[model samples]
Target chain A: MFQVNADVIAKEEVIPGVFSLTIVSPVISENAKPGQFVHIACNQGGNFILRRPFSIHRIVPGKAFEILFRVVGRGTEALSRVKVYDILDVIGPLGNGFKYSERITSALLVAGGLGLAPLLYLAEELTNEQVKFYPMLGAQTKTKLLRYIDFKRIGKKTYVATDDGSSGHNGTVADLLNRTIHYIRPEIIYACGPEPMLRKVAQTADEFGVKCQVSLETKMACGVGVCLGCACVTRQGYKMVCKDGPVFDARDIIWDKEEIEPTLLGGYRCETAKVSDPG
Target chain B: MKNPVMPASGTFGAGREYSEFIDLNCLGALVVKTVTLRPRDGNAPPRLYEVSSGMLNSIGLQNEGIDHFIEHDLPYLRQFDVPIIINIAGNTLEEYAQLCREIKGVEGISGIELNISCPNIKAGGIAFGASSRLAEQVTAAARYNTDLPLIVKLTPNVYNVSKIAQAVVYGGANAVSLINTLVGMSIDTNTFKPHLGNITGGLSGPAIKPVAVRMVWEVAQTVKVPIIGIGGINSTLDAIEFLLAGATAVAIGTANFVNPRVMIEIIDGIESFLRQRNMSDIRQIIGKVKV
Candidate 1:
C-alpha cells in the first residue's frame, strides 16, 4: 500500500447522509482489488485523529478510484464537506480482498446500507471474469438503496430489499436471498452489509452448502492492523479485520460473538473477541 | 549514522503489517506488542476513540502469551536484520520473571522491554509503574530472570517520573523508555457518556509531545541509562527534540496510523539533518540543549 495525496475530482451526495468521492490516484486504482479498502485521513483541521477506512467503490486504472461513505460521525461529516480539488491522504488498497476462484461460475452479491461500497467493485470484477452473478441490495428505505442502477447497468439481474416496503421486497435482503436461493442456485455468495444481515446470510449459505465470503465493519484506529482495535473473533481466534481480512469466509467468522437482529439496523450488538489462549 | 528509529510497542504489532509498506531494515529496532503470562482479551468494544489532536485507546493489552510469540511471531520478525525487542507485561513480579525466563535463550531477540505503563489493564499494569518501589521491584525481577538487555518502560501518569526512572535503573535496568501513553478520558457530548468502552483510556499523538519532552528532560538528570523517548514522535524534528531533551532514541507510535512510512521518513530526515550539519556522530548533539 502506498500513501499518496489524492486529489478529489468529484464529491457528490448519493443519498442524504451518504456521499461518493472520486479520487485521482493511479497507484491505488491500478492495484486495488475487489475486496480491498482505503484508509482516508479526514480533515486534520477537524477533530478527526484517526484515518477512516472506506471500501473502494470503483476503480479506473492508471487514473482514479471512487469511495462511498455515510456521515455516521464527526469524521465522516467533516469529510462530506471536502470540496473538489481538496487533497486527501489516502493509504490503500489495504486488507485482504474477496478471494477470486476459477471454480465458481454462478455467484450471489449481497450488500446492505453503505456495504454496497466494496461489492460494487466486486460486481465489476465478477462481470469481467465471466462469472454469472446476481446483485442483492438492501437498505432501511428505498431512498437508501444506493447505486441500484449501477448494478443493473452491469447487465446482470439485480434484486432489492428494504425494511419499509418502499422497495422491491418488503423485508431484509437475507429474506430475498432465502426466497430466491433455490431458483438462483448460486455456487458462491459474496456479501458486505450490516452484521445482522451478514449473519443471516451466512447461516443461509451454510444450510444451502454454498461458499460465502463476508466483509466486516468495525471502528478501527489503524487500518494497517497494528492497533488491534478492529479484531473480530473467528473459530481460529482473534483476527484483525484490517489485516487478516476485512473480508473472510462466512464459515470462519464467529457469528455467536455478535447478536444482530434481522430487520433492526440499530439493534446490532457485538462484543470484542477474546484471545482464547495467549500462549 | 545510527539514527535509532523504532516503532513503540503496542503501536507496531509484529512489524508484519507495515513491512508491506516500508522496509523493516529502515528501523533501528522492532519492539513487538506487550505479551503477558496469559492471554489478555483486552477491553470491550469501542476500544478506540479519536480525540481532538490524538486518540484514546483502551485496548487492555490484548496479546497471546510469550510462548505464542516465541513459537509464531518471533520467527517471522527474525527474518529482518534489525534487532528485535520483545515487550512484556505481567500481573505480578513472578509473572514478569516467568516471561523473562520463557524468553531467555530465544533466538533472534536482542532485548526485552518491560512494560509497566499499560493504563488499560486493571492489575499490575500502570499500577506497578505508578510507584518507584513497585517499578524497581518489577524491573529487578525481570533483570534477574534473563540475560537479555532490559529496558523498563515508564508511565507518564506518575507524579514523579524521574524517581521511577532512577529506581528502575538502580534495580538493574540497562535502559529506560519513557512516557508511555498518558492516562486520559473523554466524554461524548451527545451521549453524555465516556467515549472509550473502558470508560477511560490512554491518550497518544501530537497532543502529548510537550509533556513527553518535559518528562524525558526530567528523567535524564536522574538516571544514567539510555532513554528511549516515546510519545507523539511523528517526525525527525520530534525525535530531535526528544534527543535534545536527553533521549538517546525515540519511538514513533500513533503516527504509524497516519502514514505507515512515517518512521522511515523520520529516519531519512534525521540522516539528512545530520549530513547537512556535517555532524560526525549523533552523540555530539544529544542532550546539548543550551537551556
Candidate 2:
C-alpha cells in the first residue's frame, strides 16, 4: 500500500509493439508474488490517470523490483516516454496472485500474447519447486512471439504456436493443446491468454477430467477490490477479479460471450454462460 | 492537526476495505459517501474514464441514503478514533436540512460537509454551487439543522468561486472545502463517441491540481473560514502546494482509484516535508503563501 516513486532502470523492445520496462522498487520486489502486478503511473506526473497494471515479470533481487509489460494502450504508450532515472508513482503487488501449491508435481503453462508476462514468473516458481513444466507459447505472428530461450532454459519442454504460418506451428495455442495434451498428460494446468483461448482450454481440460486454472483480466478501478469494478461471473456468482482472482479455476467460472458486453461490464463481456450453482 | 489527509466522499467507504492494508485511524479524518434521503442505485455503467493526467467519474452520488447510513455505516465508522465528516447532498433545500438534522446527534460524527458540487446528477448538478444565492441558501438550511461545524464544499464549475465561498461563510459555514471535481468529457476517436455513460463527468487527479490550488487560494482569501482542498493530489509535493495555497486540510480523491493507500502516504509525506524543512507545527505551512 506504499506509494513509492520508482526509477526506470532499464527498457527494451522485446518485439514490435512490445516493450519491457524494469523499475527499481525494493518494497515491491520484496513483497511481490508470481501473478501479482504493479499499477504504474506513467507520463509526466499522473498525466494518465489510471495506473497501468503490469505483471511482476521477474523480481530482480536488488534495491528495486522489476515489472515487464508491452506497450499496449494509452497508458503504456505514455510509459515508453519515461527515461532512465525518471520517477514513476507505483502502487502494487496488488490483487490476489497465483497460488503455488507444493502438492502439485507437474505443471502445464499456457499463454497468449502479453498474457505470457505473468506465466514466465510462474514457470520460474515451478522450476524452483522442481515441478516438471510443459510450456505452450502463442502469438498472432512470428514477430509477436516472445523469445522462448528463457523458458527453454528451465522448462522440461516448450511448444510454440502462431495464428499466421510465420512461426513454429501454424495454429492457435488451443490447436497445439488439442494435439499434445494426451502426450504431456499434465496433472494441473495454469493458463493466461485471450478469453476465447482460455475458454477453449478450460473446456478441453474439463473434458479430459484434469484441473485447470486461469488468470482473468478486467478493467479495474481500485485494483484492491473496493470499487467492484473488476468482477467476473463465477459458479458462486459475481466475484471480484481483483480480490477473488486475477486467478480462478476454469471450472469455477461461467463463461458468457454476450455477458462480456463492452463498456457495460468493464470494457469486456461474456454473456453466453453463467456460473453453475457453486453447490 | 495530525496529518491533513482525508478521503473524499463515496471514494473511501466506511474504511472497512482499507483496514486490511493500513491503519484507518492514522488519517486526519474520514469522509463518508454523500448520503441522500433514500438509498440511491447511482448512475449507469461506464461511471468512470481516464482523462489526461486525471479521470472523470459519474457515480451519481449512489448510496443507501441517510437513514441507512445512520443505522449501518455510522455504527461501524464510530469504532475509529478519527473525526467523521458526513457528506450530505439533496435535490431540494428542505431535503438537505432534513438529512443534516437526522445525523445531528450521531456519536463519532465530528462535522458535516455539505456536498454542493456533485455534477453527476441532473436535479442538483452544480445548481447550488454555480450561484452564491443557492450556495448560501443551502448552507443556511444545513447550518440551521446542525450545531456541528458546517463545511460547505464549493464546485469549480462556477465563475468567481470566491463569491460563492463568501456567501456560504455569511450563511454560517464554519469552513469550506474546494474545489470539487471539474466537469469534463472524453471521446473515443475510433467510434467518434463520448467515453463515459453520463456523456460528461467530473474530472479529478493530478491534472486538475493546479486549478484546485488556485481556487483554494482564491476562496481562502475571500472567506474567513477554513478551506479543505481536494483534486489531483497523488504525491507529497502536491499536498504541500495545496497547504501553501491556503488549504487548512486536503482530500485525496481520484488517486484512491490508482492507489488505495495514497491518503496514508500523503499524510506521511507531509510530516517528512515538515521535518526536512525544520518546521514543527503544520499550521506554519498552511496558507503561508498569499498570492
TM-score, each model? 0.87, 0.75
Put down candidate 2 lDDT per residue, A78-164, tens digits, no spaces.
Answer: 887777888888877776777767778778898987778888888888888888888899989887888488888999989999999
Interface RMSD of candidate 1?
Answer: 7.6
- Compute the lDDT of residue B109 as modeled in candidate 2: 91
Give the alpha-carbon lDDT of every model.
0.86, 0.80
Tens-digit lDDT track for model 1 on B34-71? 98776666665567888878888888888767778888
Instruction: Name the docking class for model 1.
Output: acceptable
TM-score of chain B of each: 0.98, 0.97
Candidate 1: the clashing residue pairs are A278-B64, A278-B65, A279-B65
Q: How close to the true structure is residue A79 of candidate 1, measured as C-alpha lDDT?
A: 90
Per lDDT, the best of the predicted structures is 1
> In DockQ terms, which candidate is top?
1
Residue lDDT tens for model 1, A1-279:
888998999989987888999999999998999989999988754445778999999988789999999998887988999999999999998999999765677889999888889999998888788878899999899878889999998836999999999989999999999988988889999999999999999999999999999999888888887898886767665678998899999999877735422111111012222233344
Q: What is the DockQ of each candidate?
A: 0.32, 0.17
Native contact recovery (fnat) for each candidate is 0.43, 0.23
